[model samples]
Target chain A: MHFVDMLVHRWDLARALGRPYAAPDELTRVLNPCGGSAARLAPDDRLLPGDRPGRVTTPAIDDRDDRRGPRAEHGGPTALARRTGRKGSYPMWCSSVLRRPRRLFAVAVLAVAFPGLAACGSGSGGAASAAAPAYAPAATPTATSGAGAGGGTTPPSTPAPMPGMSGMATGAPGAGGATAAGKPVSATRVAIQNFAFSPATVTVKAGTTVTWTNQDSDPHTVTAKSGAGPDSPTLDQGATYQYTFTKAGQYAYLCTIHPFMLGTVVVTP
Target chain B: MSRRQLARHGAWFGAAVALSVVGGEVISSVVGGTTSAAAAADDTATLRFVQVSDSHLGFTGTANPDVTGSFAHAIDQVNALPYRPDFVMHTGDLTHLSTAAQFDQVKQMLGGVRAGSVHTVPGEHDAIHDHGRGYLSTFGAGSAGDGWYSFDLKGVHVLALVNTLSLEKLGHLGPDQLDFVRRDVAGLSSDTPILVFSHIPLFAMYPEWGWGTDDAAQALSHLRRFSSVTCLNGHVHQLFTKTEGTVTFHSATTTAYPLPRPGVGPAPTPQTLPAGRLRAALGIREVSHVQGQTTLAIKDSVLS
Candidate 1:
């Protein structure tokens, strides 16, 4: 169930970002919570009232100040509010409060009594009241705004930090843990410079997290064309991306932004 | 007795004594000197030649930035020898990317050698880029169409094989070149000494890495009748010597870089050595073949 929710979330993120939805098999493999902390939410589960079929409309989120577009808005309640517009303000507040330990206790009792009512009157009560004026006729007590309200608005000016979403900083395993898992086993150092990865072939252990540090003055990405582990993120210059493979395979990767910069990581078990 | 008679008697006695002394000296010299002179002759005829292979000059990388310098150092070692070598033979890969500049540099550096002559064969690296055009342009004529040529010197027939060009399925001498070698050696007596040279090993050193020639057996068949056949090759930049029947295969070191030992790792490619140890890793060889000898004496030395 949680796996499906993660997949749905990922699919929504992909769609919002104007990317093709990951195939079902790819989603099943990548978003599998076999070893992760995120509990798998089944496709039928009603953890979020908005997930119920026909019970809730698509929430319209607005981002009026983001320069890169609406997809650039990161995880945060404010960004979620902006994405779903005024009508979604209450649901966004409820999700934030549900994520909090203190408010989760209060909402737990409320959740059992009235499953649909839990979406309203949670955190950020100020924004919820102010956004009530924008609610349209179709807006039921549960209905949220659709994609049209803030579709063309400028993205949010401020980036929001998602409470439970692991940001890039904490996305990678700890350095000591990564090292203990056999990082840099090849004793070979490959430097990515001038938008090109040096020593195109790098051999490492299966559990080793090969860190591709962007040394180019411009922003670049290290996207794997093959054998990339789940949660592998693109990195910018001066930023680093690490992938830890649990199984031995040759991971052929190239910068998605710069297809010419090709490289391969040979993971040995 | 007259003074003359006394002097004569004394002179006769002195002459007898002087003759005894002279005879003793001659006998001692004959008895003691033979072994020393024989040893000295053996030492004097101990011909040594440096076999530097796969110089691959004009390569610029951390693997081997100063390939030319390392090669020149090998030459310097050859020049600084107490007994200057008769000649030097580079098996192949005299250039890295096989550029004209690389060949020119190699030619100029090799020209500085005081040896009698320097023989060469083409390596895969030499032919891969230009299909051996630049190499042929620089070192063609005397070499046959594909650079397979043989010459006799100091009682040894040195056959430079062009296996790189006429490479078989697994790097071998094509039937045509094999026939050429057969015809080249058919006239020579069976007792004649033979030294075969090629870029890739005539024996199977490492087939997976393309180290061995496919039809080396066919090429070796022609020289089986010879008293001594020494096969020397240089594709892998390390020294490995193996003997099969009358043939001895010796792979020479590269002046440019080192490669992982066969089967030591997943694949074999030129490895970048530490900045300081690059010179010591490059080596040279000396080969001396005596007439009527079954074994060719070889001495290996590094540039450092």
Candidate 2:
């Protein structure tokens, strides 16, 4: 079928399946671009095609000037039919068939297509297109409506790997074979020198472990104040210590040996 | 006139005149000697000195546990200086936990300094538990209300302001104290140097942490008429200095412990350092003011 015909057919199917259709006025504007009115759609309107004769009718046009009427039938549909030389009889057989099963069939079609049209209008299709697997609800007959409906956009279940990843990326490998969130965790090597910790402030996610290496000749202890209790063992020169911060806050620390040396760590969840 | 009458009258007049001349000579001699002695004392200039603050003794926390040791060490260092300071001034925070025992320990230790008498002010910690009762009992004899006092050293007019009491969000110099300062320096000439010492930083270093003094501007405003004013403070455990017009504000580091750098975290408080590095963290600063020079040269040295 032509694209326009296919679109109209789909719209009709959606409406027939109990899907909400545009209002009558909107429908008329969409269907009849030349300005069809609601009165034209009434059951007794005679402008309907032959198979559905008298689908619409107006009393003013049909029975105007009744006193002078019937003297000469020259201005009405009857006159027009005579002029055209077509039969005056209605198509009784077609109307009879349309009266019973046709209405039931239209209702059934609308009932089947209503949910699909509603889902499409709600932008669930866009969500499905972005991360199909992540957003895919469950295995069900209705789930098929999600596929190809969102134009292949789907949310990613796992973050994409990138070069120069700092092991901070979720699911990326870190130093010492630790992975962020279940992947290989990456290592972050921080050095303490000149009585000061390099990168005095560091930001990391919860469960990410930070390792401190003492490069200074003297020994230093990583002491957090009493309330800020996630602490590390005192690391001597050429020695290393590590701690995993489970909670998030500003952890201000200094070398127990060198009180002047100070650093901070910020953990974000 | 008869010879006898003339001779008697002349003798009486001559004796009276002679008495007047003797009285004049005696008065001149006494006044001249007093003026000469005062000039001699003035020629031997009085010593001017700087005030160090917040040396909290017996603070065993990491910020600086060996606070007393460092302070004693600082005293020894000061004593060993090439030129003996006229005297030393300790603005306040003389002890970490202001116990009678701590105050006693500070007195004994500071007594060993051969330089001169040490002037003291109260710190929040020193006054927190005792409400300054013990501080006053130990050091209050010559001091004014709540240990606020002033004295003259050399040519400088030194004022020790008590801010620990009436401590607001920042330090406070209440109306009474301000009025005292106004009257205290009212008679001094503009050329006379002035030094104001308090426990908290007079300028707004970091008000959220109570590192600054409120109403310092009022005290400072009173001092603006003077040609030279130096304001020294200690609280943040670090060194910071600023000069506004004729007033120079200096924040001295704590002899007890080092605090977190300002605004580096949610709030700033004393941080614990390793026992071995405590001495390195604590230090003393010396400020020398030459009379003719506009600037005071400051030297900070760590306690080895």
* Predictions' DockQ, in order: 0.01, 0.01
* Highest TM-score scorer: 1
The most accurate candidate by lDDT is: 1
lDDT (tens digit, per residue) of candidate 1 on B173-290:
7788889898999999886667788988786554434566767777787887885677878877765554434566667667676766553332343566676665455433333333
Give the alpha carbon lDDT tens digit for every residue of A1-269 in model 2. 24334334655554346453332344434433323221111211122222132121111111112112221122222222222221122111112321222332232223122322322332533232222211111111111111112111111111222222222222212233221212222235445653445555567787777888776444556767447544665465578888888898777776543344556667778
lDDT value, candidate 1, whole model: 0.49
**TM-score of chain A by itself in each prediction:** 0.30, 0.30
TM-score list, all predictions: 0.45, 0.44
Give chain B TM-scores in order.
Answer: 0.77, 0.76
Off by over 4 Å in 1: A1-269, B1-48, B166-169, B275-304
lDDT of 2 by residue, B255-275 (tens): 555665443222244566576
